[model samples]
Target chain A: MSLFKNDSDFKMDVLREVGNIGAGNAATALSTLLNKPVDMAVPTVSLLPFEAIAERVGGSEAVVIAIFLRVDGDAPGNMFFIINREPARRILQGLLGFDAAENDNYSELELSALSEIGNILAGSYLTSLADFTGLHMSPTVPSLAVDMAGAILSYGLLQFGTMGDDALLIDTTFLEGQQEAEGHFFLIPDPESFDKLFRALGVPL
Target chain B: MTEGTLIKVGMADLNIADGGAMLRTTGLGSCVGLTLYDPHLKLGGMAHIMLPSSDIAREGQLNIAKYADTAVPELLQRMISKGAVTGRLLAKMAGGAQMFAFMGGTDTMRIGPRNVEATKLALERFEIPLVSEDTGGNYGRTVELNSLTGVFSIRSVQHGVKEI
Candidate 1:
């Protein structure tokens, strides 16, 4: 009775719309923080079988920064924020105005700042998503990492779910003046979370 | 005839020389390659940072040269010690690419872009103008910087060879 059955395209379209709202919120937050107008591209969202995630992002040799979150309440779900490491660091540096010759070591202060930045961006984005979908949810504390393709992929796969289930990933870019940053938003729901989301979205039980 | 001197920079070693050193690296993917040259002192330095921060690196491996967060400072300090003045220095950077395209979803693996951004920030903080850079592609780049002339070359799978 649910049109959701075998409707991958429909699912992708719904997720893209959700992503657009989320990115808009993130851009607004970023603009306020930097005191500059921030323009974000419309998000590109895809729903892939978990098995394909590793292959999709792992083809290149670049650093990855991933933030994981758990969304709960009426529609329980899991979410992740992924970005290329260079963009993450650039965003941090741009925000802080730190120089190249300054101490390259990241003190707890700097790391904390970075984490807070990620939290703000991801939080605003996901909150807007929940509003659009008529669900109530909040994000978890942000996490950061700098690692190879294999290490990042393995970590995400292990932490989220097995390879068979479908994973939703949303890609977007943040642009302000000459600075640009790109990131991915991934949602992989566990069995319970998946059920909650379906119920909240008014999908047939 | 000028002798081409080879300086092999280990994890945290900052190599700086005046008028005659050739700094080189074999395999560079996500790590950063930074070159700073002081015109007045005729001195130059290069550092290869493997990660973003030394604080997060493994124990017993807490060296300034091992991470971008530490290597940039150490490199500048070493250059200063070698009679290179900070105000007269100019910086050039390369490397930091997602060599493989498969790891798309996770944020933890995006270190290449981070390294480049971190390095740029460090340079800017030091008031060092970034004269040139080649960063953030989907391919690995091997770079060679000539300390004496401040000229560098980047060789990658996609872009054959170009001077920066």
Candidate 2:
């Protein structure tokens, strides 16, 4: 039931490039905000089951800070900025000058601040993508949630659920210095949006 | 503590448990975790229903466990074949939370309520009594159903754990 069953290796490469460009711009935006270097790994595009998507972040029960935005326009999709608890705390400390609590509970102000950071990065990601493909893409007002990666990410998979249990996602991991991954950008275009996206990028559908 | 095997139900998947096994599913947001239990047989079944209906399915082959309308009947049939009676079966469900609230809601954002509604309708068609439900919030839930005790325990980060 894969939508990309007829898709070629070249199409996946194009999607990888899409993830690369979008995440590159977003990494640059984060570096500017933190006044430190932010590095990104090569984006990986995968067609995975709903269960496996959570495993990438850790597991189904792994608590995470997720900033979600609905991509609106010609190439509509779902975008998520996911970070673990520790890295999220570091981000708050570095950007807002406030030390996060040792516990997982986040204050109202902290949640709002993190939401804004997600908003900015998602905006840059879409802007660069729009420019690259010559497509009209924009993001709605971003929302923030601190919960299990599976729950937060499942929201992005509803559109694909009707088609199948698996979804195709373009994932990019962000690294802070030489340490492990600090965060990730998951770009899940809706099942219907793929044709439009490939067409917009001059790939035959 | 009642010691038993834990049978896991994954996203858009369903399974049945018996012989004192506990059926569990995790991280349910906007997706309904519907369960059917026969207190007499101590047989339990759970489905992580992700969508309202399969009528709109574009896939060549539909996954019956992924939709509310389809999963309900399939779960019941499996339970019935395993010596559970439909007339004596009772239902309990959780999850179906709107994890994030948007300003102007779309059909996608309203999937939680839609899934709940579709599941209820399917249950009514089967004449299964929905004994209790914990649903419709802005949070995610992880639920477990004890086949031995018939207690559905729901755990969430905000409200801790409760049994129904």
Candidate 3:
């Protein structure tokens, strides 16, 4: 709660730019992977209650494919790349020559390929943020899961849960050719990380 | 069977129901969904525990239902206030899942198992029996408990549906 003592509009604008630079790079990476132009939405920084965070993607029961990466350097945080089922299938069909599985069960190869894509995007996101802020931010090995949105997203909220019922996150959407929402990029920096992040960016605490 | 109210328990939340009501918590991953039921009174309580202990909590106003250590006692006291006997209370639990696994994992990464262990320990401290449990998988689960029948149902993506 005290992290954003002021919760100032100026602070939110700073976070928006941070999300912009990070997810913009990630969208570019996804575009190169699919060899198509990918459009991105303006990043939104919100301090949402725990339940509402999951609702952003869908309800608690909404099944989705999530790639989780633990950012492990200065200004540590949690990064998630979440994709809906049908869009994931489309991505698989477009990128690889294999027909995507029709059911929830994904072949091991398919899962690996999806994880690799997530790793590439998350890596690029962190790299860009690192360069822009001059903070050494790196990601651990990315982990992938196809499960309920609440469950997957909750992992990123544990740190905030310790602080309060609310969590602050920067959310960005990735769109494919038709402007259909293809994926979401969620950046939930740990409660303690915000101070370091703002300090690094020359924003007064 | 007559229709009963369905109480939705959100993340880091808890509730108690009586008669034929159902207590449900959805999409529990690396979080434990622990329930307390008194068959004689047909009363039930559910807690969606996100962490093992409140000792690590830094929140100014601690959410008792958010931690395994605190949720158990709070649920028990609520049941008691509603005239449910402690001796008649038993526990059934599900949803301590390792949703994602890293190569070299840390303690926080193993939170699912820790939550299960802490919930069980809390029940132990209260001298309640853990009759059945469905826990510790690499999957997310939605769990529900029927207060009237004392039946616990666990639903997951990989595992269709089963009762504990």
* Poorest 10 consecutive residues by lDDT, candidate 3 chain B: B1-10
Predicted candidate 2 versus true structure: per-residue lDDT over A110-181, tens digit per residue: 899899999999999999999999899999999999987878999999888878889999999999999899
List clashing residue pairs in candidate 3.
none
Interface RMSD of each: 12.7, 0.8, 0.6
Where in model 1 is the C-alpha error above 4 Å? A1-4, A49-61, A100-105, A163-166, A177-181, A191-195, A203-205, B1-164
Tens-digit lDDT track of model 1 for B17-62: 6667678653466667888888776677888766665545433335
lDDT of 2 by residue, B1-164 (tens): 23589889999899998878899999999999999999998989999999999997887788999999899999999999999999999999998899999998999999999999999999999999999999999888999999987899999988999999
Share of native interface contacts present in candidate 1: 0.00
How do the candidates score on chain B by TM-score? Answer: 0.89, 0.97, 0.97
Per-residue alpha-carbon lDDT of model 1 for A1-205, expressed as tens digits? 1224655575656656666788789888877876778787777765554435644544323445556555546655555666655655666677778741133345566666766777888889878877776777776555554443333443333222222234455666666656645555555544345445555666444
Worst 10 residues of 1 chain A by lDDT: A155-164
Against the true structure, candidate 1 reaches a TM-score of 0.47
